[model samples]
Target: MLDWMNRYRRNRMVDHYITQLGPALRKRYGLREQYTVPQIQKTLVAIHLNTHYLAYAVALYRHEASRNTVNLRLSQTFLDSLRAEMAKRYFHGRDSYRAHDVLGLVKTSRWRGGRSADGVRSWVAGAAD
Candidate 1:
C-alpha cells in the first residue's frame, strides 16, 4: 500500500513536470505543424541533448504540437535518437540503464531557480486559451 502510494505520487509529479515543460520547449524551439519529420526529430534530439533527461524528452515528444505534426515512424526514430543522446550524456560508457534511472537523476530543483512555478502555471494556462 505504501509503495503504491509512493508510485502514484511520483507519477503525478512526472505528469506535472511534463505538462509544464512541453509547451515551453515547443515555443522555444519553434516546433510547428510546418516542420518536417526529420526536422522535428532533430529538435527532439536537441532537447534531450540539452536536458540530459528522458522524462523531458518524452514530455516534449508527447506535446500537442508533436502529436499533431510528427508521424509514428518519425516519432520512433526520434526516440532512438533520444536514447542515443541519453547514453552519450548520462550513461558515461556504462552498458545499460533504465528510463527510470535517467528520470530519477533529473533535478527538479533547477526549475525553481529561474522561473517560479506560479509563473509557469500562468504562462501555460494562458497558452492553452
Candidate 2:
C-alpha cells in the first residue's frame, strides 16, 4: 500500500492545487490554498490511526461475546470518528460545503434530498466529471 501511495502521490500534479487537480474535484467544493498536500497527508494519517483504533475495538467486541460485561463500548464513537474524518478530508473540516450538505453514495443528491438534488444536478450538468 505504501508503494502504491508513493507512486500515485508522485504522479499526481501538486502545483496549482485546484486546477491541476482536474474538474472532478470541482471548484464549488471550496478548495483553496489551505487544502495542500501536507495538510491532506496529515489528515489521512489521522484517519489511519482511527482505523487502527476501530480494528482493535472490533476485536475486543468479538472477545466480549462470551462475557456478561463488555469493557469496550464505542458504537457512537466509531460513527462519530468516521464522520469527523470524512469532514476533515473531503469537506476541509467545514460544517457544510455547498447548497446542501446531503451526501449521496451512488448518485450525487439525485435520489436523496430532492431540493438539493435538483439544485446540484442542474449546477454541475456541464462538467466532465
Please tell me which predicted candidate would have the highest lDDT against the true structure.
Answer: 1
* Reference-based TM-score of each model: 0.28, 0.23
Model 2 lDDT per residue over 32-108, tens place: 32232223334335333222233222221121122211233434455345445445644567523321231221143
Query: Largest TM-score belongs to which candidate?
Result: 1
lDDT of each: 0.47, 0.33
**What is the Å distance of residue 101 in model 2 from its true position?**
1.0
In model 1, which regions exceed 4 Å deviation? 32-53, 56-129
Instruction: Kindly list the per-residue Cα lDDT of model 1 for residues 44-77, writing each as its tens digit.
Output: 5654433324333453344232453344533645
Candidate 2 TM-score, true structure as reference: 0.23
**Would you list the clashing residue pairs of candidate 1?**
none
Q: Cα RMSD (Å) between model 1 and the true structure?
A: 15.8
